[model samples]
Target: MTKTFKTLDDFLGTHFIYTYDNGWEYEWYAKNDHTVDYRIHGGMVAGRWVKDQEANIVMLTEGIYKVAWTEPTGTDVALDFLPNENKVNGTIFFPKWVQDHPEITVTFQNDHIDLMEASREKYATYPKLVVPEFAHITYTGDAGQNNEDVIAEAPYKGLPDDIRNGQYFDQNYHRINK
Candidate 1:
């Protein structure tokens, strides 16, 4: 059977990177509506891992997409992509005992640097395409520490002002200790 979802349609074939106010940077690739390939640049729970999860994408409105997924560690992540508005709204539900402390969660806004963007209209429409296999990520034993120079040259200097100045619906979000 063929299935076409507006949410998924809006996200396919896009790549971008964003950094949280708290210094967390992530790169995301829209492999399909059902999943996203993501890599954590660094932060509280830094890692040199690329992970893809079965994600749910929904178009909340024109040019606004909501993507959510649960990680293997049982942490839940929900994010709103407002590319037209140049910002993202998200919350991370940290699994207990995994973060090395008693802290639990955080919600934040950040600006995105769009690496590539494409529309479903540009490609032939498909009801449902055969999804790809699980991803494989390779890493060298000493790459993490040895890559400090490259990390310092990361594209982000700080959270962009547009994101810092954007209005948010979730005003109840507060910064918590990690």
Candidate 2:
């Protein structure tokens, strides 16, 4: 038997750390306002609305939910959520890029998220391949800290200079207070 959540409300008030594929990181929060806020550390030090739309949560199976939304760029994204395991699986579709290499699967776990590019011979020319193969996003502290501090303490801190500065997406992000 598996547990099921009645609504997206179950995820409200939760905080998470999101790490992009390019090593950029941000703190994420699901607010009561139905908006997802992001605390960026690069150029902006403030929390802003990265997603304001209401997420469409559909129960796919027992203990499994499908959350989806459309981006401002008209791209539709969806994630399969397994609340019991605190995990999410999703594929990011890049409509404007090479059609064959449009989708990349990402796995988000309790402590980390895998952001490696999907294996495909068609993506052989992708620039990110030059960097370390396995990229992961790990949880850190709160936002508002200096970028230097974040980078210094990241798991990738010991990576080669070229790989660190390369197109790798490995990063550490902070989680906001609930």
Candidate 3:
């Protein structure tokens, strides 16, 4: 079959998933030509946090195109979407700041004084200047089995009320009964 992808507009309001070969999977829902919501299926933010990012897309051929976006945390990710073959070429570019500053983490306070429970935004108590150095993380991946993915309605939409309330750390899985 001939692929006729000319621009991101071709897939507006569409949901797609990338099942990366590296054992990771992510869901992407294109809200429009410039915005997309992605959900991470694993790791610290898995099923807990989701972000809508401004995306930049480009077409390389009929069925192939690249979609790139800068996450709020400064991680740059680019994915070459091959819709017809259910394939994707993905690259996650990490700035040196991620490795150079390991101490930076989520601070409930020092950032959000208005919110009653926790800061809805990144705890900006301490900000760093990232150098131009970057590491290119490349991976070849397959598409999701289907496009009927569960979309995160909002940022951190999957967060539990207990965690969002900060009654305690969600460490039930880590703490052993002693």
Say which candidate scores most in lDDT: 3
By summed lDDT, the worst window of 10 consecutive residues in model 1 runs over: 108-117
After superposition, the stretches of candidate 1 with alpha carbons farther than 4 Å from their true spots are: 1-8, 101-178
Q: Which residue pairs come into collision in candidate 2?
A: 21-169
**Global lDDT of each candidate:** 0.44, 0.37, 0.46
TM-score, per-candidate, Cα-based: 0.51, 0.38, 0.52
Candidates 1 and 3, the one with greater TM-score = 3
**59-138 per-residue lDDT for model 2 (tens digits):** 66665656566543233556565555645555444333223332232212112212222233224433321111111324
lDDT string, candidate 3, 92-126, tens digits: 65444443432231222123234412222434323
Our tally of clashes for model 3 stands at 0
Compute the lDDT for candidate 1. 0.44
Question: What alpha-carbon RMSD in Å does predicted model 2 have with respect to the real structure?
Answer: 13.4
How much is the lDDT of residue 98 in candidate 1?
36
Predicted structure with the largest TM-score when compared to the true one = 3
Per-residue lDDT of model 1, residues 132-172, tens digit only:
11111111011111122112212233322222343211232
Candidate 2: residue 62 Cα off by (Å): 5.3
Q: Which window of 10 residues has the lowest lDDT sum in candidate 3?
A: 134-143
Where is model 2 poorest over a 10-residue stretch in terms of lDDT?
A: 105-114
Pairs clashing within candidate 3: none
